[model samples]
Target chain A: MRVGIVVFPGSNCDRDCARAVAEVSGRPAAWIWHKDRDLGGADLVIVPGGFSYGDYLRCGAIARFSPVMEEVVAFARRGGPVIGICNGFQILTEAGLLPGALMRNVGLKFICQDVHLSVGDTGSPLLGGYRPGQVVRMPVAHADGRFHADAETLSRIEGEGRVAFRYCDAEGRVGGPSNPNGSLAAIAGIVSPGGNVLGMMPHPERAAEAILGGTDGRALFVAALSRAA
Target chain B: MKARVYVTLRQGVLDPQGRAVLHALSSLGFDQVRDARIGKYVELEIADGPRDEAEKAVREMARRLLANPVIEDFRVEIPGEGEAR
Candidate 1:
């Protein structure tokens, strides 16, 4: 798969995300800058983590108007695969590709640590490697990872099986101990209505390699690649 | 002529920064705070011209750059004589 990572001015995780795709999927992804209006012929587009534009006017607010986003939106509308991780998740929500919004942590502090995530299902490619409610360890770091959606939208997402991952412990239970960011319904990630676009607060690219981190995040990219290919 | 824009998070969405401020106030021994929400507003002075043209440009500014309509909504108010604030 030809993967592409959008690079904003303050996107610190772009390289890591590219490396993750290259190592895990054996695909050398391209880096698309924020100013460019083209996507450079990528099958899967990834909006990587980190504070875009320093999270100045709300996370992803300024970056949404970036020139490349127009093409990204068009690509997504054409049923191409797209993933938004961490602040990328914030960007997806800001761009209206995903529902709900990320609020401040319940503890109101910047949380940067390894977190436990539970695969909710194998419906979407992002979690195709795991069974329902399977536990996986990955790192999460964000001050505004608390997901908030209206009652109607939240129910629609759950009822439609759009929730891809949930926060959980080793035993696969949802709560404060398992969910560090206090996301609504312990949601760690969600897919779009069409299931082609995904937005999550955790950093899957950070743990894609066992040498540098853990291999738990590796399967996610592989799954996307398999489907995209 | 001058134009002002107001931006705010939609209803039913949580405002973490506003909540933090309220928590800080409560911890400072001040209670009775019902709620708090944060928003941004900007005022811009521009050339005098057709009112319709000015409003259209300002609205484009809001949609294209000033606001993210998905999470937050924005409004433009070009103050005029005999106008309500």
Candidate 2:
């Protein structure tokens, strides 16, 4: 399976994401520059994490207008597997590919640490590796990661089973300080209505290597490739 | 022409920065300060044009880029142009 990693000007995690995809699926991923208009026939497209556009104006706000995003949007519209990590998630929301916006953390601090996440949805390819209610650990690094949406939208997303992950304690209980960024309902990840697009604040690639501490994140890439094949 | 835009979080949306500022003020003996809300102030310079058209363009910009309608509200002002508040 071919994986495409989109790179924006300030994206710092493209190489890492590519390595994770290659390691998990044994296929070297291709790099798609922000200026490029095509996805290079990728079966899966990944928007890697980084401070795109230097986080100017707003996180991912400027990167949403990148030429490559036009093709990414089209690919997602065609029900292609698309995953956005961290700032990439912000970009997807900013581009209207996903619902809601990621606002600044409730503490106004740049949070960087490993967090426990409870899988909430198992129907999507991105999260199919884990069973619902399972807890996994992934590192998150961002200042603006609190997800915000209207009450109606939040209710609809939850009711539709679009929520893919929620912050939780080691015991798998969600809420309170278990929420690292104070995201609404402790949401850490979500999938689109079509289940082809996913945006999450945590850096799954960072946790995909055993050398990096844990390999739970590798299963996500494996599941994506498995579904694509 | 030039335009100034003010982007503020919508009512009921939590503003962590604003809360921090309020706490700082309270610590500085400014107990009278009941609240604080921090927002963005952007200034733009564009080609001089019809007042109506200019307002329309800037409004579009605010909606599309300057502010995220999900949690923030934006106001555009054209200085000395009969107040397009």
Best by TM-score: 2
Per-residue CA lDDT of model 2 for A23-127, tens digit only, reads 888879999999999999998999999999999999999999999999999999999999999999999999999999999999988999999999987388778
After superposition, candidate 1 runs with Cα above 4 Å error? B27-29, B50-75, B81-85
In order, the first chain's TM-score in every candidate is 0.96, 0.98
Candidate 1 chain B superposition, TM-score:
0.80
lDDT of 1 at B10: 81
Quantify how close model 2 is to the true structure by its C-alpha RMSD in Å. 1.6
TM-scores for every predicted model:
0.88, 0.97
True-vs-predicted CA distance for residue A66, candidate 2, Å = 0.5
Interface RMSD of 1: 2.7
The 10-residue segment with the lowest total lDDT in model 2 chain A:
A120-129
Give the residue spans of candidate 2 off by over 4 A.
B81-85
lDDT of 1 by residue, A1-229 (tens): 6888999999989999989888877768899999988899888899999999999867888888798988988898898899999999998888888998887787779999888887765387666767777788889989988988878899999999898788888777777677887788999899998888999888888888887578888888888888877
The TM-score between candidate 1 and the true structure equals 0.88
**Index of the highest-lDDT prediction:** 2
Q: How good is model 2 by TM-score?
A: 0.97
